[model samples]
Target: MSITEQIRSLEELASVDAELKILEDQLNQERSTLDALRGSLQKLEDKLKTDRAHIAALDKTRSDLVAEVRQMNQQIEHSREKMNRSRNEREANAAQRELEELRKLLRDREEEIGKLTTEAEGARQGIEGTEGEASKISAELGSQEGDISSRLSEVESQKAKRVTDREVAAKKLPPVLYRRYEQIRSKRGTGIAQTSDGTCKACNMALPPQLFHRLRREPLLDQCPSCNRIIYFVSPAAAAQPVKEG
Candidate 1:
């Protein structure tokens, strides 16, 4: 094939390959973002569940405290009723002293109920705080989910467009030039390089004067001795020629 045709073919192939690489990198990034978002969502869900369980336990504790307090009140009422029926009927000083002691016992139990009520109030406040925190976390997780979905969709669309562009550029090359370019790219990571001022751009090696002069004649495809890549001279006028069949 003509040198210019070879360069154009290789250039188009390189463009397509570069675009495909970028698309793959972007796809990987998008997938990573999705995975991280899902993980955060799962963590938030677990935290919410744990918070709810703790709140439920706190509620049960408060309820039990209230029931105990009610039971204490009932006992105090019964004791008072008994003391009234006795009506100072006990003539012994010891009996009067015993009734006073029972009254003191009821007073102590009342104080205990008051302490329990305060503790229950504290527990209720804690439950409220946990619920608020859980709600905030849930809302954050929802927003992340939506954001990740939107980002992934955008990446997918961009990737599709890049792939289409790559395909179109690949089709511009002749079949043989296209196949050779693909083979070299797969094996060496680059299929073509420019030879300018006696230097091979691919390897940055100064070509021998004999080789550099030979390339100027546009005889045939030339592989750089140093880098093993097809070398072409870039010229705007020569770039439009059709590739000659070998």
Candidate 2:
């Protein structure tokens, strides 16, 4: 193929490569988001489990306290009956003291039960809040997964077609030229750059008059000295028209 035709083919391949890179980057970003969502959900689930365990422990403590309080109440009732049966003042006073001590123990146990009950309520609330958050995240993750899957399929299809096009374009060029194009693309992300009005479009550097003249006369691919990119000259008519930036 002629150098001009070869340049055109390289340009086509470069366009395809650019598109593929964009699709791949997008796919990676979506996958990363999916991973982050899953990680967050796992952490929330772990926290919920811990909170439930804490509540269970608190419930057991409360139950033990209740049983102790009941036992204390029974002891106080027996002490009261003993005081009623006491004949002497000294024995009656001793029975009263015993009853007071039993009552005190019962009060202390009840207070502990109240505290434990409050703590268990707090833990239950925490679990509810965490479950709500997890549900929200799970719904969002589901939607995102669907979108990513569809987008991935579309991107893969387009990428496959572009790969085929790139292969066909590469085959048209001489092996040496094709290799040079690949090397430049690897470094600069673009191999072929169009020039307009004596300026290298890729680097926006002004080309020397002599080099521009050579580019027009030589009919072979030329590299820009400043940027080392493959450069092509456009006709004045094309140059006069506004060119869109890539």
Candidate 3:
């Protein structure tokens, strides 16, 4: 291939490769997003499970407290009946003291039941709130599933087309030049670098005056001394042409 044809083929291949890279990057980002969404869903599910377990524990506590309160009530009633049956002053005094102690015990048990009831209510509310949030997240995830899948399919199709184009473009160059381009690309991610105003755009380094003159005079491929990337010069008119993909 002539020097100009070689540069054109390389440029076309580079363009396609760049596009393919973009598509691949997009695919990676989309996959990450899907993974993140699923992770969030898993977290919500775990939290919901924990909340349910907490509520169950609270309910058991409340039931135990209620049973204790009922027992205390029955004991206080029996103490009251014993006080009514007292005959002498000493017996009445003793019965009165006994009744006071039983009432105090009953009051303490009722207080505990009240506290547990409140705690159980709070736990119930927590379960409701968590369930609502999980539902919202589930809906949002469901909505994104179709869109992500469609975008992934489209990106894969585009990447396949670009790969084909790149193969065709690579075939146009001589074997030695193609191998050299691949070597540079492997190291630097881009093999071809355009030059502007005596500067290598890739490395942003100044080209030697002699080298720049040679590049302009000879129809040959040249490498940047600083970065070793294939260099090409574009005239003002040529640069103005609309860039097209091969």
> Which prediction has the highest TM-score against the true structure?
3
lDDT of 2 by residue, 154-225 (tens): 878887887888788778878888888888777777777767567887877888988888776766568888
Question: Ranking under lDDT, best-scoring first?
Answer: 2, 3, 1
Tell me, by lDDT, which candidate is best.
Answer: 2
Least well predicted 10-residue stretch by lDDT in candidate 2: 237-246
Rank list by TM-score:
3, 2, 1
Expressed as tens digits, the lDDT of each residue in 111-222 for candidate 1 is: 6657656665665676576566657766766777687678777877877887777677777777877777777667667677776567776677888788888876664467
How far does residue 120 in candidate 2 sit from its true spot (Å)?
A: 2.5
Q: How much lDDT does each candidate structure score?
A: 0.66, 0.82, 0.80
Candidate 2, position 6, lDDT: 76
* Candidate 3 wrongly placed segments (more than 4 Å): 1-5, 75-109, 168-189, 220-228, 240-246
